[model samples]
Target: MRLALTSDNIAGACEAVVAEMIKAAQGEAMPYGGDPLTEQVTKMFAELFECDVAVFLVSTGTAANVLSLAALTPPWGSVLCHPESHIVNDECSAPEFYTNGARLVGVAGEEAKISVSALEQAINKRMGDVHSVQPSAVSLSQVTEIGSVYSLAELQEISQLAHSKGLKVHMDGARFANALVSLGCTPAQMTWQSGIDIVSFGATKNGAMAAEAIVVFDKNLAQKLALLRKRGGHLHSKMRLLSAQMLGYLSDDVWLNNARHANAMMALLQKGMASIAGVEIIAPAQANMLFCRLPVGMAEALLAQGFSFYTGRWEEGVVRFVTSFQTQQADVEDFIACARDLSTSHTKTS
Candidate 1:
């Protein structure tokens, strides 16, 4: 009856990764992503993306994102992104710091998806002037800060618009697999084929214990990431630990399976939540995240009963519940039951 759907399960790196890690420890391998497994994973990425991709593994999504942005933007330039984007808000200005003082400008849009007009405005508002930060790149989140996703057309529109402005495109794909499943598109179509120049290909949020990657679609931007990752202090000496997690995450299509389960659970919960009075679905029930509103007292009562979800960060009474590979139908049911019970009580009293 414990439903604490806040983030992905870090229950010791999933089964497949654990096996890979144990094998990695049993023998010698190159350090700093020069090992056989790293090479093989690189091939996996290239094949998965349907192009010659330059891949770099990191231990955290923030590192993957900041390092990639640093390579794409000069210190004097700026990156335009959704106001709630991880780079703009959550990463503690790491993108700006990593890029040595590049500016992070917010692009306003609905559902945290930046619109083409907003991009045009953000880019033109002092871009390429000697007195202000130049627009060097743009960053987008696949499964946006809210639950909604960018459609293929949305991605193409933004990417094409950014490129025409001489800005490279980067995607914060922390929920890459979840969005991929939701959109039913190939990785290539979701990214490079749609004009994405770089991607922070995330696995930790799906099933990996601690693994994320920067995938370079524009092959020319490849070399600098290695040095940037090392300088940023994410170059693991035992590189195979990170490599093993990604390898296993990609194997048997576990990443997609995990995401599919999470997304399915989100869909189920959204459907059930609609019937609960006073519970408002605040955002589109897309991917594995949901935004909804509950009465303040009911929220407190649910948390007191050990049903946990994010609250009070974005706004009062509105919260986000995230499903992961470990989230269960029973958990969802119990949560809904608790919320419904509290809602009933609150209504009767009011």
Candidate 2:
């Protein structure tokens, strides 16, 4: 039936998370994240990270990222990140707004994973120059925009570089679970233990109703993040609902399971696509995303078949197919079949 290959938000909430929210709604709990559930969820996150991390819940990934950057950077500072990163491109100045005028300096990277060299150059270009903003933070995406995953070693190299240059590292982990599941690495291995200072742990895109957490590894930055999230108007009055979503998502490793399924679907889609005619993969299918170029006719036919995905500005022949936790294997097969049929029809017509 209805196949969604647009974004992870198309996925519905997990039953456990839904039940937790319903249960939370039945109680007379304190508001503004002072409730027991919120406290318990934060504790769970801390334990998961294997450190006393500060966890702040937000309604969206953008809020989690922008608010975390606000806590890390000052008004006059800047954040160094890949040119195609969500924080630099998707946030639409949310980082700047939350940071009271901090700017983002984009580094050159193909898959939105900041290379140590590119980061160093980007930060160096802004240094020893009063006219330019000072580099205060470096942000990287775990599962990059081009569907590439950063290895733990790569993250360590980038993190060590940022810290050596007196900058903190922030990770826009919108597809964190996808990357983590693929890497088969613990959260701590990809983060704090590897020099990450904060992470925007995304849940809405996975299976939660609407939830994201800003994880601050450094305790000193915790108070500032709390104040910033409150001032940014992200402090939910009925914060237990958000907490419930996160708690249930992480309760029995549902988050990892969901991500694993999504990644598997992407892999299947990628394999099916590679066998088709006139279809080329633009990037490696490392996580839940598949960036590829299809024949103009096949792209148009797929669009006509109720298959929805980005055409990347309606170019002559290119598209982006995004898989999610809810993307079914049958849907992937149907889409591949559609592409095959379209290619055959186009050949006959031509």
**Per-residue lDDT over 1-350 for candidate 2, one digit per residue giving the tens place of the 0 to 100 score:** 45768788877898888999999989599999989999999899988999898899999999998998998888889988888888877888888888999988888876667777778888888586899799999988888988899999999999889899899999989889999999999999989989999999998889899999999999999898888888899999999999999988999999999999999999999998999888888887899998888876676677778988878653557677788888888889988888888877877888
Q: Relative to the true structure, how large is the alpha-carbon lDDT of every model? A: 0.89, 0.88
**TM-score (all chains, Cα) for each model:** 0.97, 0.97
* Candidate 1: clashing pairs of residues: none
Show pairs that collide, candidate 2: none
Off by over 4 Å in 1: 9-12
Q: What tens digits encode model 1's per-residue C-alpha lDDT throughout 1-350? A: 38887666432456787777777788788888789999999999999999999999998899999999999999999999998898887889888789999999889999999979989998988875799999999999999989899999999999999999899999999999999999999999999999999999989888888999899998888778878888889889999888888888999998999899999999988987888998889996789999998876877888889877788887888888888888888889888887888888888889
- Model 1 residue 336 CA deviation (Å) reads 1.0
